[model samples]
Target: MPSAEAPAAAAMDGEQRLHPWSWLFVLLQQLRQFVLPLVALLVFGGGGGREAQWQALAAAIAMVVLVAVSLLQFFTYRYRVGADGVTIRSGWLQRNLREIPFNRIHNVTLHQSLLHRVFGVAEVRLESAGGNKPEAQMRVLGLAAAQALEDVIRHGGSDRAGRTPDAAEPADVPLLALDTADVLRLGFISNRGMIVVAVAFSALWQIFPERVASRWVEQHAQQLLGYATSMHLGVLSTVAAVGSLITFGLLLTRVLSMLLALTQFHGFRLHEQPQRLTVERGLLARLRTSVSRRRIQSWTLQEGWLQRCLRRRNLRIDTAVAETGNRSDARALKELAPIATPDACDALIQHLLPHAQWPMPAWSPLSASMRWRLLLPTVLVLLVLSVPAWLQAGPWGLCIWLWLPWAIYGAWQQTRRAGYAVDTALVAVRGGWWARYWRFAEIDKLQALRLSHSPLDRRCGTASLWLDTAGASNMQPPLRIRFMPEVQAQALYRQLSAALAARRLRW
Candidate 1:
């Protein structure tokens, strides 16, 4: 007697269920809390001591009691999906109810651990653009069910006519996904060496005093020669051996810490949806970040040494949002999550501004003056490095010699890749070597534009135009397009000013 549409709707509703794996997680948590304390107590208690045995038993019993209470509390927790929002009910002593509206949900991420994968289940994390933590999370759910929920929210659910919601109609935006090639490109261009150096330096700071003392003792050993002859050989040798062991331990710890941090962030993925970009990464404690399109202020493309070899580039997007806010401000908030890859970045921007033109122009090479201007920074850095080396190694200290060619090459490549093109509504700039980047911005969104000339640049008849946007307030020099003809720079500035002025009037 029921209609065909009615049965289909019922089937969709039936697919939504509580994740079965929640029970396993609760059980594991309870076991860890109860068992670990008992094991610790037994390990530390002295054998055949009546007082220690009694004390250990009392601690273990207390831990078990606390864990039992927690398990009871967890059993009462439950969640349900409804027409307007998701409802969560929990707490044994005081029942709590919370609702999360569909519109407020930024992105739903399905995470699968090895255990979950084997069991064919996944955890669902609901992220909001405004919140400091997950807006809502369900620990276990069927993979199909999770996907269905994501689809429903992404498409705004079903209509009264019983037709499934159209995913493309509301935003008509294209989703951007990065391939493996893009991920490799991002990893190569990233400052992996710099990250490792920073981690190693921080670790060294923690153990520096001990290291310095040991080094001083070793270097001044001849000063202690008089004392060493009278001291027991065994004691002196033991002290030397312990110092060596400590130094080795410190070095190993620093290396491991750096490796862990670097490897964790190696493979990154930036997935673009209609309204937001989701950044998922890390080998441990995987991070899922949602960045809304409306919050983005500006974008940049970068390419470095390794990226050039792979013919790839990195893209960074800057968003506008206050990093600190109130608790309620935690519920939904704006974020600036940078994504890598120029092509994917361009796709995202084009979705946001479909009318804009791209790949505008590839002009002549960098002028002689521009090349020299870029080289000046390399020269300054070399001078700074040389001062210390010269003081330590005298006139023969050529340790800094190794960096000169690399610095010069980097400067040359940077100048060569720096170029810009302007159309009626959009402006594009291309730069970087290992990871090539092409940044596009609407002329209307540009807050300010200026043509700048250094004494060196002026003498060579070259100019650079800097573009500022509402986003990326912290960026140095904001938006810079280096090495341009003076005439072209002035013309581009005029056109951008006019477009921005028109946008203001319309708004």
Candidate 2:
């Protein structure tokens, strides 16, 4: 296979074609989208007598249509490198054509699934600066061709016209490497352990009856918590038993998280180039992506209560490009460090933004009066709940009132965590209570500025400021500061305004 970056020979056509195996990828994808319905119909056909034949025929027709569609897709799809941009043309009826210029290409992800690896083909997903969908997705390209295409999109490809592709350059440097041990560590701290349990439980239910496990868990819960025990159980003993169960559950989750992490980041590598950063990881569905430094909109560091206890942090980068339809882009690009020590996390920040230094944020803390506003909302909810409780059991109904003190403590903790600061390089915000988090973005990347004031805020002489940017997703934080002192909020707004006006926007 010829590299897409090289100048094509006169005998060879400039237009590129996918591997013959792309037809299989298309068929598998199409089948996946309709497998559930197909199975349901087949089951229904088995249950019914005369109607079974018609149902089976309908399912067969659906399968044939799906296969035909995939075949047509493979036949019609075409992609080629041009002087101005990379072009992708597809669709027989709608006839969709997409061309993405070099500057518009924000990021490129090269992925290979189990089948893709077997066929020596890759999926090249190109994400642009602005859009909901991906710029183009070349589902099956040769490994070398995909690499060359990604490189051509990133750097200037026009200069390589009428020439062969070059080998690895000296500018590339190995920045980070994650071993099996590191991946195992990442799994424990990932905080995403329920997926496995849920899938397993669902599969069990589908295979057997729901009561198979649910009843057993209920019976065990009764036995362990003293409901069915012969010995007398005091309140403290019951509480301790429940707490122990919770601790065991948390430990199980951590173990599961670690196992899942090992699967996702089995062989992770971070590479640094002159203008771009590349990441390669995974054992099953491999991911290889490059994100340009110029497209980075912001950086965020998060520490959950469990993570905080372990002195671990999750770091993510917010880029200008779209997220490629699903979280594959986020899973690959947003995560700068999935799991690392605080010092290692700080080092990653420095490595990513070498021009910027970590300055002490001069925070304007939220005022004490802000608690009154926070408490009011909770008070109304308590009042509404108390009405129903009073109707049921008079004096005992007010027991829900005990939750007030806990709620107040939570609100106070939030007040302590809430603050905003701005420095020469980044704007910072600290918020959240049990799971406190800090969000930071570069000062020059401000997209929009908004100052909001309520009647209470006006009376308290405070306001809220929102900092909008292009890089917003589930992975990154919303850059908004609530309940800031009016004078300080206005001052920061003015500074950010000046910063925005002075520099040209990137996205």
**Quick one: best lDDT, which candidate?**
2
Candidate 2 weakest lDDT stretch, 10 residues: 1-10
lDDT for model 2 = 0.76
Q: For residues 1-507, could you state the per-residue lDDT of candidate 1 as single tens digits?
A: 000011213334422435545667555655764554455445544567798778868877876776566555447666655566666777778888877777666555666555666676656767554444666666666666655565555544443225554323343232544444444444444555455667766655443455674787677986667566676568769689669878886665555544554444434555455566655555433443455565566666555555556555445665543223343232222222233444655565566667765546544455555667777767777788788879898987757777778877877777777666667766777666644566656666677778898886776676788887654455533477786667766777787777777775210
The global C-alpha lDDT for each of the candidates, from Candidate 1 onward, is 0.58, 0.76
In Å, residue 265's CA in model 1 sits off its true spot by 14
Local lDDT at 8 for model 2? 32
* Candidate 2: C-alpha RMSD after superposition: 3.9
Model 2, range 189-234, lDDT digits (tens) per residue?
A: 6676877788777765554445666887788888865653666767
- Runs of candidate 2 exceeding 4 Å displacement: 1-13, 43-46, 158-168, 199-249, 323-332, 359-361, 454-461, 473-476
Compared with the true structure, model 2 gives a TM-score of: 0.87
